[model samples]
Target: MIQLHEQGAYYFDDQIYLESEKKNDAWFDPEAGKKKTMAYKIMQAHNHSGNDRILELKFDSIASHDITFVGIIQTAKASGIEKFPIPYVLTNCHNSLCAVGGTINADDHFFGLSAAKKYGGTFVPPHVAVIHQYMREMMAGGGKMILGSDSHTRYGALGTMAIGEGGGELVKQLLNKTYDTHYPEIVGVHLTGKPKPGVGPQDVALSIIGKVFANGFVKNRVMEFIGPGIANLSVEFRNGIDVMTTETTCLSSIWATDTQVQDYLTTHCRGNDYKELKPENGAYYDRFITVDLDQMECMIALPFHPSNVFSIRELNENLEDILHETEVRGQALLEGSDVTFTLTDKIRNGRLFAEQGSIAGCAGGTYDNICAAANILSGKSVGNEEFSLSVYPASMPVYQCLMDNGSASALMTAGAIFKTAFCGPCFGGGDTPANNTLSIRHTTRNFIHREGSKPQDGQLSSVALMDARSIAASAVNHGLITAATELLQEEKAIPKYFFNKEIYENRVFQAHDQIQKDLPLRIGPNIAEWPEFNALTDDMLLKVTAVLKDPVTTTDELIPSGDTSSYRSNPIKLSEFTLSRKDPHYVPRAKAIREVELERLAGHDVRQTDEGLAAVYGSIQNHFPDFEYDKAIVGSVIYANKPGDGSAREQAASCQKVLGGYANIAKEYATKRYRSNLINWGILPLITPDEIELKNGDYILLRGVRKSLEEGSNRFEAYLVNEDLQKINLGMEALTADEIQILLAGCLINFNKKEVLV
Candidate 1:
């Protein structure tokens, strides 16, 4: 069970006290207590803004995988970056299984190698490691801060404070600029109990996520792990929980370091990087969470989200009612499609049955988790049903260790397929399940379509998240969804993990921070430059191309992952897939509007391109005879209840930008990274505090738009041109001076340089 303390609290002497209970204590001074957190210390070391209120941070290292690096490097190169200022590791894990795109995946890998050689960075070959795993094995250092372009970039368990963000944030570091943000609120995650043997880190993490995500208790706040419970878990167990902190929508996470952390770093050949980190006598937390790991049970997160969690015991007792509710939700997700999904049908003799099982990615593929699972499935078979099991180690070194220790062979002998290091299972790129089947996975997310089921293509599948132990147990039960605890068997005789650095030394291309200035850059045929972007105009018009009524919309819905991500290096081609899954007609509609804007930019009359647009202009002129067409720009916008929830993939915003998207109207943004993505792509993040009626084909016009932003106006007047002019006001949060500059210049690229490359 997890308990949330919404009221502010402080941690002292391994005891948490709310202000109401501890105001009498001498250590209860809020001002001094704020500086006692582990997060504050790490941020203080990296912050160069001269003050703690606003952090202008410089990370010690930055990283990105193939799904992101090509675009990030292209942006930095356009901004006149000559050499990487800090350690930059480009890993090829996300696109390692490239069965969908022809030769493009390998092409991106070669380009990463060329970029690494030319800019003095490190390039890890395909299957070398997933981004976060490689960072853990090599780059994580105690008391240091790292930034990555992947959402799950967490190394807090290793005593490193790491943040996952969009590519623009990485570009700033490459250009020796600062990552600007107000000092984030810190939340103390106090753990005091040891987890039961059958319960893995995913169970503890999902329990916390289920308690916190829906209420936004820790949104955009740093979660600091501390307490007596820290010493009870191994370093890898802490890592499994830390990496999934991204699901709680937290900004970043850090843990108090112990001798175990020192040992972990030492084993990875980084003993000197270890540092003692702990909360001072008293540390203030804006919010607090207490996780009782002793009561943790085998957990499962049903389809559609990682936060929709329940204990396996609870589900078994309430099977019928829960299945009915999930069936209804699944139907909503498959609405207007030919696909039909019913979880109730999976029931066989009153027990739920799934068709596939996966234990992979940064969350589940750690050395400890796999060894435990292999031990559980040592002599048992997964059976010859449709139920198949696959396992992927987090890194090649981990795989090699398993191979050396017979863990890999044990799983393979039990009919479980072993794979190399890859993140495809986490993002729907590989190991996709069959239609209408249920997959029990130990990956990071179970969001709709996250398991690579394309409902648009009349295929649908459901994914439920469980720990590797439960997944292995269910595999032995012919996918009957059994809890690992019911089997009453624990891991025994597991060998110690032996990391093989020779794997990297033999195949990885390490530039060693020495720039190869004379080396020629390699350009892949599929890699394309970004299209030209126009700066903001005094007058702006945005056509509503799509309206989503979902309570929370993820980045996966904005621009899908998997096969569509293959075109990310080419802005034009990638933009074509924008909203392709959620709104199939969005691209054509945006493209049509883009054509009209292109004509306007060329000094041609945009009214001549479309009759409806001509009529709208006439109506605008009729309302105000001085309407200025020359000072205006037209684009598209999308309205969602709350958007940008899941991944930190910048293509969610960049693809929209390349397709003529200028703004997004949402009640609130789900995560900081998504909003940053929007700003980095020059798209305005607009909010509507009150209900506003909107339709797909409606147009909203804002006069003196650029002037309002320049004047620092938080709310601006706008007209919604449905039939008659209707007054509207859209709210905008105050932007940083740099953010405003980037918007005015159209994007990060234009803000950094005046030269335009075609």
Candidate 2:
């Protein structure tokens, strides 16, 4: 059903599938010998250098969900922020349910509403909307760039270049500082041909992800959608596929807008916001990926990752081998854990089946996908067996659309319990499965424990990603594995979509026309104030407490979302959970080092921090009369072979920062967003050289570290602060000019403040 060319192909106009050997010759005029490209033209149109390249972006609006907004606004407020400089939408989608964490979850919602009023912002009540969906309907406009705290914040399908970044980045935007970065290469995702009847956008997107992800073909590149296939897909179809582009690790995405896109904006009463954007005729691209939609088929992305993909046809034929390989890979990925996972067991009676099904989150919980699912499961029951189905509409408006179209009635009749918009299932806060159960879902991710099973607790469950139509088709047979393609018989009729914009008009609070007045914000006991941070010292020592070797580590694994949602507004309490879910030993180790920092901050004897440290400081004072323990700062650091892979959660870095983590020493970072989070939180993002062998708990003192950062020194020396306080030479790597300044000032917020005062 699916085929991949061994060599990559490029799209120039409607012609694709040309051999690489002929690519240069076909475009080159032999007599003139002139070669033109898309990237060269587009970059020239938008590119600026040095300080000018750093854009002072002004947003008309800002939107965030429960899992992120509290921390974002808190950070902004801490940086001397008063009155939001722009419109901000605080939506309660991620923590909409008060099921977990008792009163803390709802307490965050009230805090959000109060902050909106106090700061002259907007608030969307719980279950009212998901972050990205609401932004698309109300906030997105042509040629504007939006920044969200959620990682899946790609609204480019609506003609806006939206970026999903850590909360600190949002704080910088609120402070009127530029989003500093060198220009990024733009990649053309040229599409052609209409998708086959049964093929969904997820299948097409999965096909591209499988091909490009591992090779880093599109890493940190802007994917600009173009070509004829844009006309064949609806705006929602493009949006579903666009959100999953985060899996490819692209910097951001944008699409060439058309009348269909205009209609979507108009339907949401934003017609005036529409603007068509396209690259120049001879636009240069760093690389190009050409997709033929007619060749696409119903697909699946297997457990543990979104890029581990295969067609349903290939999976059914090679189930045993694939499952065996997956189990082996899982063991390797999890460091040979005692936990056992078996997918071959589902191959009973010559059919593959899953015990549960879910269609939720911003990626799957859309009106089109849900209604298509209802059409597929119309009269069929999901069965009275263990095979259960749950559906979460992306927003109240989408849910209202489903109800008006009778799709909600059809789904409920087939044993599907509809839920409100919540990001839990996508991040392991909802839809937990029984031990050893396999679930098929259309959510954003299927990372380990993301379905809410902790192997450390002796219970485990796994998830495989499928589109909503195929998920519902599997439910129709009560756990019998089936493809939606086979269910689309000639007699079956798929209903047309009818969107009603009135529901949004009645419910959503549009801040575009709201008047601003100085108001008092409601703060609860659970919402605590931030502790003051210190500036960088001339010398530093960090004890490496935890060492992780996972190929890629997500922020969810580092901090975990399900149980910690309640403590988000309270940093001191929430910091206790930092790395607790992944390491378990991380808390005590981090706390031990934090005690030393606390004592040093109070100008007390080292004994107050640790008796052992007091004795060591005495010895150092004897050697150098000027050596003062009271002036020194002590902190912890974590070493990961490679970490910071998923989500733009600033909490990952903020939690570490709050727990006396001065820096993260890593071989490399998984994504640019994560590294940016570290820098924003004043946690050094250091890259250890290949020859460097850092042991756990080895205290290395970085001498003149602050001076080196300010003086633009790329290489510096470090001393191994042993019992004798002996100095040793250690190598350091260079930092980008902006990064060095950010580190020297302690954080981005401080740097911006310094600039404003100057």
Candidate 3:
């Protein structure tokens, strides 16, 4: 059970909390109490801004996976980055499979190693560890800040405030610039009572996510975990819950660190980096959440989202009803598509089944999760039917520990396959299910087509997020949907974990400030430089290319994942897949708009391409006598209710930019990282009225957009182009000074190319 308190609250030490406004005046100071939070202390320590209202932060370290590094390095290189100023870790985890058409995946890995050496960073070889796991074991320290290109870069359980952001942010760090933002609201997550047996960390996390995600209670706020529950969970258990915070759309998360955290760091041979971190007495929280772990159930997030949750017991009781509801909701997402998304059919003879089971990635691949699965499936078998199970330890060290403890052999012998450390299963690079099947995983997300189902090709499948304990329980029953509570007997004692640092030392490449300035970067055939982008012009004319009426449009739907990720190194090639899943016509429509811009830039565009545009220009001239047709920049825009959920890949916005996208008009952005990505790619993030009507091919002229931004006006005037001009107001909210400059310069690369440092 989870309870939310949006009204500000104050906590005395870690155990007791009282409403801030209702608290006694004996010792109440909102400002002083605000400084007592663990998140505030860590952020201010990393803050370059002298004042508390604004933050110009430089992280202790940064990280990127293979799918992101090539573009990040190219952008940083184009922006005049001499060397990495911090301990940058480049891990080859996401694109580990060299199974794409050519050698692009392997090529990117080589490029990462070269960049690590040339820029004085670190590189973890493919199958060595995931980006987050490596950071947790090797780099994370108490009170340290880490910024990563991947969205699940949360190490809060270990006293580190790590944030996963777009690649542009890392490029800023590489160029010695700061990550700018204002002070964020801190939400206190008070955990009391220990988790019951068979209730894994994912169960507790889903309980909280189910309660908070829909209401947006904790969105964009830092979740600060405190209370007596801190001492009950292991470091890895806390990590399993912490990583899923990304799904709640929270900015970042941190938990009160204890001896367990100290032991975790000490075992990883970074004991000196451990600093005791706890919320000081009378800490103030803008929002407070209490999670009763004892009431947790074996939870399941049904297909299409991580928030569409239900207890396994509840699903079993209402079997057809729950599945039917999910099928109906999922069908809505695929309404115009050829494939029929169904989940009700997965119910076989009153028993639900999953075709596949996976326990991997930063959340599920921990030693604790893997051991729990092994214990549940100790003497049982997943069977030799269509059902299959696979396990991937987060790191080679975790894998070694699993092997040492005999869990790997036990599960493998029980008919589950054991794989090397890789993030493929988590993001659709490996273990993809057959068409129309369902995969129950302990991975971070369950977005549509995330399981590698190509709906466009008449293939469709879905993923249900569950704990490793429940996944193993279901696996032992030959994929019968069963909670761990039904099959789990007495809890077995887990073996002591021995951190194997030598595995990384031997396999990973570490650049101890030995920068190779003269070494040429290995340019692979698949890797390509970004095309030129123009800075913001005087005014802009935007044609609505795609209108997504979906409740939320995710990054995966924006640019897609899986095989398309093979082209991530080449911006032009990758752009071809923009909105391919959500809107098949978006690319061609956006490209047509881009062609007009290309013609205008050539000084030959005079209504020759399309006569309708000439008429719109005449109308614009009637409204403003000084209106110049050639001066207005032509680009495409997309409207969504809420966009930018799931994944911190910059390609979601960058792909749109490469295809001549100039703006994103949304009622509200789903995450701060997504909006930042849009700005970093030189796309305007506009907040429009919820009832504002927009259709594909409708044109809108933004009058003096550049001048308005220069004048620091949040509201911009635009005219909807039709037979008659209709006025509309667009809002750009809370943009920082640094963000405005990036937009004006067209993008972070172009902005940084001028060597402007903040």
Candidate 4:
């Protein structure tokens, strides 16, 4: 169903060609070779770097959710930002549940309102819209580029190139600095054929994710949508699939715009933002992914990742073998933990059973997805047999549309609970299931502990990703894990979506033209300022605090979401939960090392704090006789196979920085945003070999660390100062000039502060 082109190809006359028929054709223009791509055109329009290969981009607008905007605004304010240089939208979605931290969530909302008034930005009230949905309804424009703090910020289906990145990048935009990066490769996602009646956008998305994620086929590249299949899908259908592109590890996505896109914009009252967007007839692509939509079936991604995909029919046919494999994998994922997971117990009789089903968030809560789900469950009911269902619309307008069209009533009549616009379910803040229960959801992620179950508390539940159609099908079958195609019912006609623009007009606080600089931000007792960070010294001493063997570590594991999101506005408070889910002992160990640094800073003898640390310093002194204890920086580090997988949350790195972390050693990073988060926080992203043996508490001392970075040296030599004090080699793969300065200045905020003072 999916074919991957291993090499570069060209698209001409609506067809892909690996080689041109005539090499000497006069139509081939060398000057336009790089400009033929739709991504290139859009990026060129926004590029301020002057060079085409390396992009210093300035976005048209930027967005942040409640869990992120507070930190972003704080960072910008610290960096001397007076007013927002571009349009900024602050939406309260992730932290809308004010009951979690005793008035903290509402305090964050009020802070957002005050910041918007002071900075001349826009603020969406709680439950008005999810970040991406609000951007789609109000901000997305043809050929425009937007950056968001949430990872699922993709609106390519609307002909806009949207990227989800770290809060540091947003702070740069707020400071009127450029987002620097090398031009990304473009991968062509050529679509053909039409989807079957029961198949939904999630089916197509999961199918593509399964084929590309493991192999890194589209990692850090742009996926440009093209071909005849583009016309077969509606704008909402395209959006459902587009938003899930974040799962494929692609940098961003874009689509060829036509009447369908223009109609979508016009219907949402953004007709002026519409523009024709398409690749030139002959455009080059680094790779091509051809998906035959006709062959798509109801797909389900097993627990732990969106890439672990299998057809619903295939899973039902081979329940025992598949379930056994998943159980074994889950056990290994929770290796040192006290939780025991079992998928076999969920099997009853001959069918696989799930305890819960959900259709919510940016991926599942669209107007068409809910309408189709309601149609499937129109007359059928989800029986009270230990299986329950819930649905959350993406925005107030969508909720109002569902209410007007009776979809909400139909879903409620079928024993499914209807909720307002919220993003809690997607990130585990709401509808968390019982221990060891299996939930089938259409949310963006299914990573470990993503369902809000705390394995540390002996509470472990799992989630499997599925389309809304199949989820409704499973609900109707009493959660027997049924596929939508098994019913063979006629397709129901869906009513046209009517957007209630007044909902946002009356409720949202737009501070664009009404800046109230004197407005005082209401602060809660739980909120706190960022802790002080030490700058990089000429020499460095790093202690390995924890070594993770997981193949891919997600941001959810690094700094958990859900109930812990209430503390995000307070950096010091949030840092306490760093690695709490994955490694509970990480914080105390890092703090212990931090105390040693504090002792050295206070002019105390380093040998008196800890005997083991003194011995390591003595071993380091043996290499350099003139090495002074006061000149060396003492901090902690961690080693992971590949970190930063799931969300674009900056806390993944900031929390580490707050705990006196100096570096992260890895074979490779999972996403660009994660690595950027580390760089922004002044944490060295060291690239290490896969087979290097380093354990927790092993001290590594680097001589002339700051000088090498300042001199633009990529490779650095260090010594392992444990009992087996040996020489080791480390390298910084690609550090931009600004990134080097950021690390040297301690962080982006410090760097910007120095610049402002000058």
Whole-model Cα lDDT of every candidate shown, in order: 0.89, 0.74, 0.90, 0.89
What does the lDDT come to for candidate 2? 0.74
For each of the candidates, the C-alpha root-mean-square deviation to the true structure, in angstroms, is 1.5, 3.8, 1.3, 1.4
Q: What is candidate 1's lDDT per residue for 1-758, written digit by digit as tens?
A: 78998888988888898988988988698889999999999999999999998999999999999989999999988887888989999999988976667988889999999999999999999888888899999999899999999999999999999999999999999989899899999999999888877788999999999999999999999999999998999999999999999999999999999999999888888899999889998788888998888888999999889998889999999999998898888778666677777888899888899999999999999999999899889999999979999999999999999999999999999999998899888888888888888999999998885668677888775889999999998988989988888886554755887777888889888888678977867878889988889898878888999998888899998888888878888888888888777788999999888888988888998888778888888888888788887668899999999999989999999998998999999999999999999999999999988788899888988787788889888787788985678888687877888888888888888888853342
266-323 per-residue lDDT for model 3 (tens digits): 9999999898888888788998999888777899999989899999999999999999
TM-score between model 3 and native = 0.99
Instruction: Write the number of the candidate with greater TM-score, choosing between 1 and 2.
Output: 1
TM-score to true structure, per model: 0.98, 0.90, 0.99, 0.98
Candidate 4 residues lying further than 4 Å off, grouped into runs, are 20-31
- lDDT for residue 544 in candidate 3, whole number 0-100: 98
Model 1 pairs whose backbones collide: none
lDDT of 2 at 155: 86
lDDT of 4 by residue, 488-557 (tens): 5566877899988899899998877677767766667776767777789988899999899989989998
Worst 10 residues of 3 by lDDT: 13-22
